[model samples]
Every structure is written in structure tokens, then in C-alpha cells.
Target: MGRRFEEIDWRETPIGAISLRRRLDPALDVDVYEVKLDDEYLMSSLFTVAEVELARLALAELPGADLDVAVGGLGLGHTAAAVLDDRRVRTLTVIEALDEVISWHRRGLLPLASRLTGDPRSRLVRGDFFAAVNDPTGLDPQAPGRRFDAVLVDIDHTPRHVLHPSHAAFYTAAGLHRLASRLRPGGVFALWSDDPPDDRFTGTLAEVFGTVRAHVVTFANHLTGGESANTVYVATHARPAGLA
Candidate 1:
């Protein structure tokens, strides 16, 4: 049987045209909310296990309760929704450069839209994640100088592969140091990559954080009819010598 797809909203963003769509997956026989940039598929609700795992795995490494976190890129609210699933998450500041993506959440086009936006602990901020990292004020524009226990980013495909030229900087050692500077001691930086783990990126992360590891998250591929995987790189920030 075939399926149906409906475009919920579309808008011109800084990079390209973004569209919010809902489609029925013939293979899964389920509704899949999709976010596309022009003709490229940005995210699909049907295959969000890796996205959800990105948040869960990052938060799992952290210890204790009431943890502050920041999520870069709000795609269909999967990652953000996963972060909120952890009761330890006291506050979540999601940074999205595209205002159109933010509007999708505000407009409640997706199932978790209202929950992610309306959650007392979550704050959806429309801004550039890369720019904010370099800024002395940090990601949350509302509360400057605030630091998070964990920063889970799933914007671009990988460090070597990126959607925009400007985002490439944030994947560098220098740029990552600036991001680490904003983290509280023992904080973590977790990133999602479409490709498998790359040693080059891990080396870059090691320059800033104490330890880095790549986790392979496997999921079913409807198109390929097999299991494929995505990589989640988690790096733990090390406190300065004698700082503690």
C-alpha cells in the first residue's frame, strides 16, 4: 500500500527553504513527521531512535539530579523530547539558528511540539549555536554566563560534512575549546553524526575535553531493508588542575 504526505508549513530560512511535513510510512505503517531543507530530508519521526539515543546516552554519563542542559538543533523535537525524559534535566535551552524550525515547534505541527515548548524546564531559543558558543554570554541569550552540565548537538551531518560553511568552525578544535569553556566542570559535549566515528574529530574533542568516545547506535533502515547506524560522540570536560 502507498502512503500520503502533507506539507504542514514551509518557509525560507537563512540557509534554504524549510518545510514541515507529515507522511505515512508504508513499511512501518505509521505516521512520520518530517522536516526537510529544500529537497533534502532533515529529519523523520519514524527513524528517530538515534536522535533519542543522542540525548539519553549523553545525559546518562552525567551524575546526580537537576542537571542543566543545552540542545543544538530542534528537529521534530525528538532530541529535546528525549532530554526532557530524564527527570534529572532541570533546564534545557535549545538553540536553533532557523526561526522556521522554531516556529514548527511553536505552531504544534508535531506531536511533541507542545510538550517540548510548554515544558517548564525547557526553553526554545532561536539563535545560532556556533555563534553562541564563541560568545562570552553562552547559548542562553536570556540568561547570559549560564553554563550547562551537558550540550547535545545534532545539527550537521558530521565535523567534516556540514550543511552551512559557517557551521564548519564549530567542529574545529579552537571552536570546541570555546564551547568547553562555557561548560561547568565535569560537563559533557555529545554530538550526533550520520557517518561512523572519525578519529580526527575525536582528536579535536580530546584537545578540549578529558575523554571522548564514539557510540554506534543501530536502527532499521526501511529503504535498505537492513540495519544501519549513526555515531554519537560523547566528550567529558575536564576541570583545570587544582581548580576543584
Candidate 2:
């Protein structure tokens, strides 16, 4: 129906040159949106089960109302939109390292752009997610030291495989401790990974959170003509023993 392939936007960011492209898939008979960081494929609208699940599975761990949530990446706003879907979420702060990606959403370059930018409960912030966790200001800059009910991350490929060297620290126990400090008691932390369930990372999370789970999310893969899977790690911050 449309052009076979079109690059919506391309910008050089601090991390790399990120690009947004839309192409018509003849097999699926639909338009697919994709994001690329330099030569590496970052995300695609064709397969987003895990991205949405990152928010759904994370929020499911918390049984609370009027929840404030933070999302690490704003790639296509899939994960962020999933968070807003739950009516219980009171506020959402999306911390994205690349301002170019945020501009794509605000400029309505993607399908979910309007939904994310129009939503009054959602705020798109230009900041580094991993850096914020390791900072005293925490995730939300406006409210320093502000804690959230849940933190869902979908930035790097996996804990071990990171885009930059700086991200490796956040996967460590010490770094996780810092991340845990940004959450309220009983809050949850979830991450989306391209690889299968990693036991070593689970052990590292166990040291920081009370309960940890590695979820293998499978979705139909049109390109492969089969199913592909991604991992979602959900960890809940333990409440103080005396607290009820």
C-alpha cells in the first residue's frame, strides 16, 4: 500500500546513530516499524511481546494502587504504553538516554507516539536510565530521591552483553543495590533481554531482591516462520520484616 521501505528519521545520538524505518512486509501484508542503533537492530514493531510483557509482568508483582512507575528505554514506546494500559498506574516517568528517540515520539513518527505523548499520566524525560540508578538524584530528576513502585528496563541486549561499557556496572550486585535503593519497599524491577534465561544473573538479582523470576516470552516470528523467545527478569524488593 505504501512505499516498500522508508526511513522515518535518523539522528546521531550520544550512544550511536539511531534510525527509525518503516517497511511494508509483503508476507505479513502489514507495515512494520523498526529501530536500529548504527548497524545493530535494536527493536521492531513486528515482535513486541516481550517489551509489553516487561511492564505487565513487572506490575503483576505489585498489589498496590496509584502506582508510580519508571521505564528505562523509550524505544517505540511499547513498554511505556504497556505500563499506561494498567489503570492503576498513577504516573509514569520514562528515562531515555537518546533525545532523538524521544523526538520521534513527540513528532508522531511512530504509531504509538500519540498515545505516549498525549497521555497526561506519562512523562518523557531525557536522561540516562543506568546513570540515574547510580545517582543520588535517582530516576526522576524533578523529584530528587523520589522512589517508584516499579522500574522496567529494556535497554541493552542483556546484562552481560551491553551496548556500552558503562552499562555493565548496573548488572553487578553493587549496582543492583543502588537500583534497589531507588525503589520503594516491595517495589519491582524487571528487564527485557534478547537471550534466554540466564542463571548467573538470576543469582545476582537474588542477592538484591526478595524474589526473582526469569520468564521466557515466546512470540510468533514471521521472519523465521517459527517462534522466537526473549527473557524478562522480574525482581521484587522485599519489604521490611516489621512492616505490614
Candidate 3:
């Protein structure tokens, strides 16, 4: 028999309805939510295989080095938690735009978020990631003069399809050039998408970075007993002096 949804209490924001559901075969509990305008699946606490893989790939590119990692989104804190698992990571700064989402994690409503919050290496910034990345004044001492070793961005469903219109620029050619500037020499930029990236985005990455690779991850559905696939885009910068 198929599983049914049950109510889950949310103390942070009243803009959406939250619920929990159970799957028969896998026999797991999943947290799901429906936002006011977004009818699609916003997020869940189920399987996070792809999210973990994204972190793993980014860390692998920076092997044997202590890394200052910057994460663009903090959904359910799965990716953040995965990134923090690496002892080589010196510091992890997550930029999330939603204050209510931050509250959910800080208040212990989102168990994963709460756990990540306890980690001394983790800090959250409540603002648009694009603006934060482009800030020149270096208002935040932790960010100024610090080029990231790895930037893991999961703010969009797909590279071509962004949830927020304001994020469109970040995936463009010019925008990618700006993003590449934020990376330290030999740094990596990792992006997760629900589908394979469009050619334009891939072309832009090729233009800005020396090495670019794409990988697809497939997993069995925890809820409906089906299969799903997602793609991750990884680009590594070349030594800057070579560019000149």
C-alpha cells in the first residue's frame, strides 16, 4: 500500500504546511513541506545520496589541504552536514536567504539543521548568496580577503531552471566569470542540479575554468519505490598566473 502524509508541526513560518510521511518498503519517515506558491517538492529529510556526493567530490578536489568552504544554500542542512564531516575543512560558511528556514534549524525544529548548528566550524549568513559573494566592502571579517577553496552551490533545481528569478545571473557567462574570481588558485566550484545542465552553462564553465566535469547520480526512491537521477557539475580553477 502507498504511504499517506501526516501533519508535522512547524514553529518558524506559517507561510507553508509541513508534513511527515512513511514509506512501506524502505520503512523510513520523511519530512515534506508545501510552500505557499511552490507546489513542487521543496525539501525532505529522506535520502541525501546526491547531496553527500557533491560534498565528497568538492573535498576530493582539494585533497591534503585545509579548506575554507562556502555553501550557497542550507536546505535541510544535509549538504552542510556532509561538508562539515571533513576534518580538513577549516571553516564552513553557509548563505541562506530565508530567515524562517534559519530559525527552523536554530530552534531545533529541523533536526539536521540543529545538529549542524552545534558544529563550531559552521556559520550561517541570512542573505542572498550572490550578493554575499559579490560584496566588495568586505563587511564580514570572516569573508573579506578569504577566497574560498571550494564553493558548493545547491540553490537551484537545475542550472538552467532557477527557483528565484534573481538567481538567473549567477548561472550566466558573465556571472560565472565573477564567481570564478572568488575561488583561490586551484579551487573548485560544485553545483547540484535536478537534471543534466544545459550546454550554455557548460560552455560558460569551460570558458572560465580549466577543468570541468559532470556526473550523474541515480538512487532508488525512498517514498514511491522508484528511481531518480540528478547531476552534479564540477569546475576546478587553473593556477591564476597561467591565465595571464
Candidate 4:
């Protein structure tokens, strides 16, 4: 008999009802896991190319060793896992607003749960990405005013679209400036957007950072057929005059 769909776990977060579900995929002939917030799909193991690239492209921008990084939003831990793959990384702190998401990993309900929790370089932190950015000891409570080599974010669909109303402010000029201050002089900031790049947002980034780039990452979508693309926005905090 075919296995039935299972609701692994769920919680009533400050945002809304969030759930984790597991089901078998007939097409792929494997078990698939999904995360949903209220009526919207937050993430799925089936579609993670963009999440993986979000970490890769961000690290690619910062070419150095012993890098300190903070990844905003830990959906299924794909982005956090990808960041930990680089041997040069000295430390990785994943900031997640939802306590339930962290519990899933700690409870080993997620695929990369063991890998992420066991890794000496990685740690899951319970915090809000938007509010943390503006705080002095936002990313690291132990070390106030501490900065990282790069910050990779994939919380919302786009700047125009956010999980909460409070998040919309972070996409603006004032909010971005505070975020930039948390990075080192040559630090890199990368963002994953569901929609294509917008000039208005790019313009705002340009105002704060020395360099801004939009990367179109194409991946095969088995569900939709053919290929689909997402935008990865990359910016440098007073970048040096050189390429990685």
C-alpha cells in the first residue's frame, strides 16, 4: 500500500499557522517535504535550486578565508547547509524568526537537521532578520557591533512582497543603511527574489553600497516543465577595486 501523507509538525507563530508536511512524489518516486505558512507555500525540498544558489552567489562575492556569515531565513535549511559546504567558512549563524522552524531541525524532522545541528561551523539562532539588522548586536548577541564577511537573505518573495508588514521597511533606504553598517568594509550582501530585478530597488541599494548586481539563476522546474528563473541581488559594502 502507498504511504499516506503526513503532517509532521505545526505551530501558531507570531505570523500565522506554519506547518511541515511529508508526501511521496509519484513522478520522482521519493519522499518530499514541504513547509507552508498559512495558505502560502514557504518552501519545499522539491524546489531548492534558488535557495542553494543564494548561498553560493553570496559566498562567491566574498573571496577569502575564515569568513563569518549570517543567513537570514531558515526555511528547510537548504541555504544554511549550502553556506556550510565551503571549507573556508569559519562560522555561520542562521537567524530565524520562527521558533518552530528551529525546533523542526533540532527534532530531526528536516532532512539536513543532523548535518546542520552537528556542524561546528553552523548554529541556528532564533531572531527576527528585519529587526535584528537595525540593532547593534543584531546578528551576534555575544559580540556587539560584530560584522560578517557576507549576509545572504531569502526571507520574502521580493522587496515588494514580504512575510510581515514590518519587513517592508527593511527594503527601503533607511533600513538598508542600518543593515549595511553590520557588515565589514568589504562585506557582501546578497538577496534572493522571486520576481525579476527591479530598478527602483537596485537604485536604493546603489545609494548605500558601492556596487550592486542582479544575477538571474535559471533552474529546471519539473512541476512546471522547461525552465524558470529567479533573481539574486548582490551588493558590496565599500568593495575593493578587484574581482573575486
Candidate number of the best lDDT: 2
lDDT of 2 at 182: 92
lDDT of 1 at 139: 92
Give the Å shift of residue 163 in candidate 2. Answer: 0.8
What's the lDDT for residue 111 in model 4? 84
lDDT of 1: 0.89
Clash pairs detected, candidate 2: none
lDDT of 3 by residue, 3-54 (tens): 4543333333333443333233336434343322234566655557888888
Question: What tens-digit string does per-residue lDDT give for candidate 4 at 1-244?
Answer: 1475889998898889999999998888878899999989988898789889989888988876999999999889998999999888999999999899999999999889998999999988999988889887778877788899999999998999998898999999999999998898799999999998899999999999999999888888889978988899999899556743
TM-score of 1: 0.95
Off by over 4 Å in 2: none
lDDT of candidate model 4 versus the reference: 0.90
Task: Please list the residue runs of candidate 4 whose C-alpha ends up more than 4 Å from where it truly belongs after superposition.
Answer: 239-244
Q: Best-fitting candidate, measured by TM-score?
A: 2
Candidate 2 lDDT score relative to the true structure: 0.94
Q: List per-prediction Cα lDDT, in the order shown.
A: 0.89, 0.94, 0.75, 0.90
The better-scoring model by lDDT among 3 and 4 is 4
Candidate 1 least-lDDT 10 residues: 1-10
* TM-score per candidate, chains pooled: 0.95, 0.98, 0.84, 0.95
Give the per-residue lDDT of model 2 (tens digit) for 130-188.
88998889999999999999999999999999999999999999999999999999999
Q: After superposition, how far is residue 101 of candidate 1 from its true place, in Å?
A: 1.2
Q: What range of 10 consecutive residues in model 2 has the weakest lDDT sum?
A: 9-18
